[model samples]
Target chain A: DQQVKQNSPSLSVQEGRISILNCDYTNSMFDYFLWYKKYPAEGPTFLISISSIKDKNEDGRFTVFLNKSAKHLSLHIVPSQPGDSAVYFCAAGKGGSNYKLTFGKGTLLTVNP
Target chain B: GAGVSQSPSNKVTEKGKDVELRCDPISGHTALYWYRQSLGQGLEFLIYFQGNSAPDKSGLPSDRFSAERTGGSVSTLTIQRTQQEDSAVYLCASSSRAGLNTEAFFGQGTRLTVV
Candidate 1:
């Protein structure tokens, strides 16, 4: 069973617009959620994260909103730029345990000019 | 000073043969983890090593797989009698410590092809 799932295989957005990516999970144990951006042949880079205690976390143009009751989360990038295009993976951890992360299949976001 | 590094970026071996993949975590990072990525199973945790704590091997798939970390700096993942199903990109990551919410830095990863 896939504990985490990213239903959208890919997404396209216009530059300077807001790009939103969605993810869902079946595991309720997960408390800390994070977003990682990856390029071809490169490992995923940590972008932003949100603790279960808070509904939202923002850094620069990236913001992550989490809805625990819905077991869903979304990543928003305002004024998206071409450089923001990459495969985004949503990962979650239970923390306090082993800090092991479970990642989604990833959504490839393309920002067009 | 440098980020995590993995050797033999790409390895192709015949079935029934054994292959070894190595990883060097960042200097002073007390936590290391190994994972496998495949189409069948998005990404699965293989193992983890944290300062003297008994390594977590629960994620290991079978007895044919094993891994070890030496001097708390380098780690090697060995596959005995490889099978076609074992073909996938193996990733290694490390963090300052296995703290509650510290992020991990990953290596480029070693792509293993079992032919």
Candidate 2:
């Protein structure tokens, strides 16, 4: 079963504009969420993350909003740059099992110059 | 001084052959994990190891797949009697701790193809 889902396979946005990527999860046991960005021929790197205790977490130009009621979360990048183009994977894990994460298929985001 | 490093950047073997992929995690990171990414499977968790703890092998797909971490530093994933389904990029990751949702650093990955 697809516990974590990224419904959109691809997304496109203009540079310097705001970009939003969405993800949903079916597992209520998950209390922690993370977003990872990956470029071609590289591994996914952690971008930002949020805990279920808070509704939002922000760092610099990146902010992650969590809506526990909706079982959804989103990553927002302001003043998007061409370098932001990559595949983003949403991951979920509970405190147990040493935080073994379950990840989505990933969304390919393209920032146009 | 370094991040996770995986060796044999690429590997090709015939069916029923055996293959070994190695990973060197960042110094002092005690938690390690192995995952496989295939076109058909997307990405699947295979195994995990934490310092002096029994690995969680629940994600391992079959009896043909196995992994070992020695001295809590380097890990090796071994596949015996490989099948075409084993073709995929095998990735290794490490974190500073076992829990608390630590940020994981991934290796460049070893691409393994079973012909």
Candidate 3:
């Protein structure tokens, strides 16, 4: 009964290329979606987020797109650098219960030089 | 501290032993949360505490798990008679407030291994 799912276990991309990571969710009550990047031996850091009301949100090189109808979302990193390599976790939470986050298994992204 | 702090980065305890993990949230944060991450699995919510209200214990897996927050600041998670399945990285996080879409800052986590 996983409410969120990251179908791809891993993704690889060349330097300066665009890398896309996808995630899906089964719970319609989730109105807020967040992406967190985690390095080895460290806690996850917030990347970007999107509300169900918006289709897309962009910050610097990172962009997140959401499709409420499809119950899907994707993270895009343009000009991906080697530093961008890490595990990306997609988490969802309802507005009412913002403290509880349902996370996916996560997708490991590797950017090669 | 500038960020959430979790003590005992790693701990190994024998089966049936009790263990206590501690978490220190940011100075003014009013919300704290506990989560567990098993190998190859996603983060699982365990419990949450918000501004003096009754803590949400719904996510706690069993009676063996319990947590308490003192003075709305520090929090401690206690596991009684730990089992092998209790092994996991226990994480603590805090936000300015709860139910506001605020991002929670996390600690490095305490890795608990039950042998």
Best by lDDT: 3
For DockQ, candidate 2 versus 3, the one ahead is 3
Model 1 DockQ reads 0.48
Q: Over the stretch B4-89, how does candidate 1's per-residue lDDT look in tens digits?
A: 89988999999999999999999999999998887544567889899888999988899999999999889999999999999998
Interface RMSD of 1: 2.8
Q: Candidate 3: list runs displaced more than 4 Å.
A: B99-103
State the C-alpha lDDT per candidate. Answer: 0.87, 0.88, 0.92
List the RMSD of every prediction in angstroms.
1.6, 1.7, 1.5
Ranking by DockQ: 3, 2, 1
Compared with the true structure, the alpha-carbon lDDT of candidate 1 equals: 0.87
> How would you encode candidate 2's per-residue C-alpha lDDT over A1-87 as one tens digit per residue?
999999999999999999999999998999888888889888778888888899999988899999999999999999899999999
DockQ (C-alpha) of model 3?
0.62
Error of 2 at B48 (Å): 1.1
DockQ of each: 0.48, 0.51, 0.62
Instruction: Kindly report, for each predicted structure in the order presented, the TM-score of its chain A compared with the true chain A.
Output: 0.96, 0.96, 0.97
B1-115 per-residue lDDT for model 2 (tens digits): 4788999999999999999999999999988989888873446788999999899999899999999999999999999999998999999989897642446788889999998
Q: Which 10 consecutive positions of candidate 1 chain B have the poorest summed lDDT?
A: B97-106
Model 1, which residues run further than 4 Å from truth? A95-98, B99-103
